[model samples]
Target: MARAEVREVVFRIRWRWVRLSAGVGAALGGLLLLWGYPQVQAVLVRSSSLRAEDVEATLARAPLLPSSTRAHLGVRYLYDPAIFDPPRALEHLRRAVRESPFDYRNWMHLGQGYEAVGDRARAEAAYRQAIAWAPEYFLPRWLYANFLLKHGERERALEAFARAARAHPEAAANIAELLQNEERVAQLARLVPEADVRARLCAFLLSRGALSAAVSLWRDLDWNEKAKLGLARIMIARGISTEHYALARALWCALGRRLSERAACSDDLVWNGGFELAPLREMVPALSLSTLGVSEEFAVPDRDFDWQIENEAGVMTRIAREEPYQGERALRIEFTRHENVRFSGVAQFVLLRPAATYEVCFAYKAEVRGDPRVVVEIVGARRGVPEENAVLFRWSLPREAGRAGWTLVREVFRTTPETSLALLRIRRVPADALADFVKGRLWFDAFSIHPIEDGVRPAEGEAL
Candidate 1:
């Protein structure tokens, strides 16, 4: 062996090591390319690709592997902006569905994702799939109706509501409310005559607790006898008063001749049989007419017995005086200010029965002021009464010049078992302390009280 031979061998060994290192580096580069291609594709699909750092950060916060790790990962990806490329999100959701096809929640989320991306047709298809998976599920129907409403397909929306109502009668009220709130109904009504819109409107109104409006609309519509009878039935179910029933009766009589002519001889037979009237009597109970007496001189100015004040400017007119029956002097105070004031009063009335709910109504006018305030104070021995005057209602009206005529303000109060005499007071706050109470004139009108039906009242023969 020689020194030159040793040097050559050493050089060859080093060359071999370099060749091996290069080959390993190339293989590692290929592996990296394979790993990065999907992420690159994701970026192409949606400009924002889920970054590795984000995925790592999320995984760091989430509970590590579990039996349902894949599903949780899917949800995380679906919600994570870095991981949630639209296409990737959809893929995750699809995987979630495949893993749990019977899961209504998964399908619902899938549908919601599609809807969020504005793929309505696909979203609808997904909703239908969810319904098919769980026919008894109420949420899918509600979602489907929402889709129909968004697409401006109102008839379809109504049909969906009908299905939802039938499936969940308890939700009938909610469905009806949705229908009534839909703007399309009004739009549709404009396209057709009032008669065509009547049934739908009645159904909508009845569902939304607009019983009075529905009954009024029903009476004016050209419904057939059976339909009219059904309307009356619903009205009775809705607790329409005798006054409303009397109005309905009058309208029925007025339409009697025309109804008979439309129905021909068969219609005449039904009308003569009094089948319609039979249900009216059976479903609607008669209300007893009762008169309520007050100490002050008050007149029922409207059908609802609204009271009014005549001479507001005349301060000589005693707003407070004793009534003939109970000897309770009524005090009336006129407000002439731009700002709201706090006024207090105590009522002296002998309650024939305790525990009755009473409605209190007052009329006031707002004059030109920056911000006019109105407050009502009811002080009585009722339990749970506030230490300060109990504020039943508060209103702020825009201060404009002159008087805005009379506006009715009302509140319903429940009287306690121990309540005897109640007090009512109206107060107006001046718009500004520096500004005089000019043009703040509020006309104090007639004040009246009525007991609420079905409200708790003292037993008969009980004295206040």
Candidate 2:
């Protein structure tokens, strides 16, 4: 019995040793594999490139591999594309994405692989899978759209482009521009139509001065407030009447229709009468009001109806941002020096009726209202006799310093029986005021010229 027990103990010890040896052998083998994997992968560069036992170790080395198959796919996409193997690359990419279902790039690369292998069905399915995984991602949708387009799947490609537009509209617009297919772009726009998208497109077109194109898109963005306002500003800058733009006119009329006396002042015969329009010149010839059949002009040397600095050598004329009587801006006339005490001020060419007694009115304030030589008159184009001692300047009253109060000035005169144009003039008449020169700024606003019944002379410079 003792001998039997000894043999059993020996057997038990031998079995334990064997099991321990097996465990140690496995540990050593695992360590060797871990250490030699990179070397083996390097050695299997081409022959067993994708099938080597150590090839998968390459993926394991990159921790982000499972999360994004892009690096693995990039390995297959060499600087020399001729060496790429789409089918072999796709096998590993599919396995990685199956392990990480949330990976968008994995699905995307799988789709690209399927496309390279000419499997259109699988390619489209893979692209859709990528989109489904990351609905807000632009790259997948953009790639999908491009892939479908490359395969001549036009309808599905448009749908994919629409998806891209929905994801990142500006990027989609860039692609649309690249496509240069106007009709297709229009159709794509209709499919995913967002007002902001339309507005952005319109704004881009308009910024490039693509007016007709912008006009075509305007109807779609008509109700968008920002777009409408931007278009209105563009129209205003063009200096053409709002009538040229039906949308702009609609906006203008909409604002007016909300108020009483909507039509009373809707049609002002003056162009930039309130001194609000830009390039602040004398009356521009592109006057929207064509009642008198005046062929308007623009940005030229005609100060016909614009307030002018008669003595530009001695005075300066500018539109001021100071306190305006009615609008945000007013006309500023600064007299720098005395050209023999006859300094220049402001003037306008008034278009009036034949045999008409009209009221010419405007607001003015002087830093120092000087000599009656400064007069305002409606004189004919043909000067028969200079009307000396005219009450044009005899009528202005002065005010305290630093006060913004304006003195209203007006005068009435009869139009010549055959006169269609008259000079609405303001100047420092040749008078004897011993200030040496007319120095100081005078602001004017709310200029209006209209005929009254019974030829009553309108009072000038009535303080408001």
Candidate 3:
């Protein structure tokens, strides 16, 4: 072959070989990239679905991913556990937030996670962050407002509701339903200066059977004359049938006054006259109405009177004497034998009118060594007369040892025609004492009974 031909042929073969090699390399590179893509995706998906144990293992292996991520993983793992692990969930949620400060969803999830874990404050912060990042999102605002409501931040909840309403006007019906369910409208009516809002609240409260609150709010707002009258009417209707006749009569009297001012009063006054105070001569002629021997009793214990200790629990031996009534007998209660003890007795009194409302007042000072639950019971002449009436009223004190200095306790009893004989009894039950073990003692004194018609007397050192 000629020299030029030989050179051309050699160059052609070398060029073809180089091109083939390049093509093979490119094909292999594409295949490798395709193979690696799924592995990378698999890693992410595995991380997303990582079991609590796996995440925990990862956390142990890599402690530098930040506390927030660990907390998030921990929360996820505990989300559906047989037992709720709030502390662990809280720790992980907190850590997740700390690790990813700018992630909005992270904050939202963290807030929910914190709530699930029972960390209210942190949950609130997380929700606030979520709201800050996505101001238009209704879920965060709704959740945050609910949280505020749960914490008794009614005003803040209202503000949050307003914001949520603005963001999601389409959700107005739902929001209204929520507000109604929460009695939000009623709450707003309490503090809201807007007349329309107050009216709405009044209607809501009335519907919810919160007549007293509704009436008070109505009087404050002065929104509806008819609504106010209606409220009073309902109250009168309900109250007159029960022991609440006195309260119902009072409300009716108020209504009568309103009617008189409007020139609406008439013969109706006599029908509502059930609440009128009777002449002293007519009510209790034997008490000498011309020169009644009425005396005001002070809460302070008289020096001449002596107190006695009665400990049913045998474990309590020595009683401690404190200030004021120091020398008076102190009752030591031992809760070792039983979880609760009842101290009770009868007071001397004769009911002039068995059907009248009698008001009982007394002062008690309790130093509870354990859990103190003091219940005062007044047995009416009627037996099995409902638990509330049988017990009259009960005041529960915490389990602590301190001088609860002469706290006044009052109970109003409605005597029936059947109640010819009645007795007053006060029982103190210690929480820590067993049914057999009575471990606490309470001091009670200055018990007196007066007709509710006479009005409540002032406490010690005060003038009525």
Q: Write the per-residue lDDT of candidate 2 for residues 140-254, one digit (tens) a residue.
A: 9898888878878888888888878778766644666645665665567676777656555554444344545655665666443444544434433332221133343343344
- Measured on C-alpha atoms, candidate 1 has an lDDT of 0.47
Measured on C-alpha atoms, candidate 3 has an lDDT of 0.52
Q: What is the lDDT of residue 142 in candidate 1?
A: 85
lDDT of 2 at 390: 28
Candidate 3 lDDT tens digits, 385-414: 223454333455544535556566656666
- Report the candidate with higher lDDT, 2 versus 3: 2
Which ranges in model 2 have alpha carbons more than 4 Å from their true place?
1-71, 78-82, 152-155, 170-172, 207-209, 222-228, 231-438, 446-464
Task: Return the top candidate by TM-score.
Answer: 2
Candidate 3 ranges beyond 4 A from true positions = 1-50, 54-75, 87-100, 115-120, 176-183, 186-464
Q: Report the lDDT of model 3 for residue 244.
A: 42
Worst 10 residues of 1 by lDDT: 299-308
Query: Per-residue error at 107 for model 1, in Å?
Result: 1.8
**Global lDDT of each model?**
0.47, 0.57, 0.52
The positional error of residue 457 in candidate 1, measured at the CA in angstroms, is 43
| lDDT of each residue in 235-274, candidate 1, tens digit only | 4434322224333333444444343443222211112221
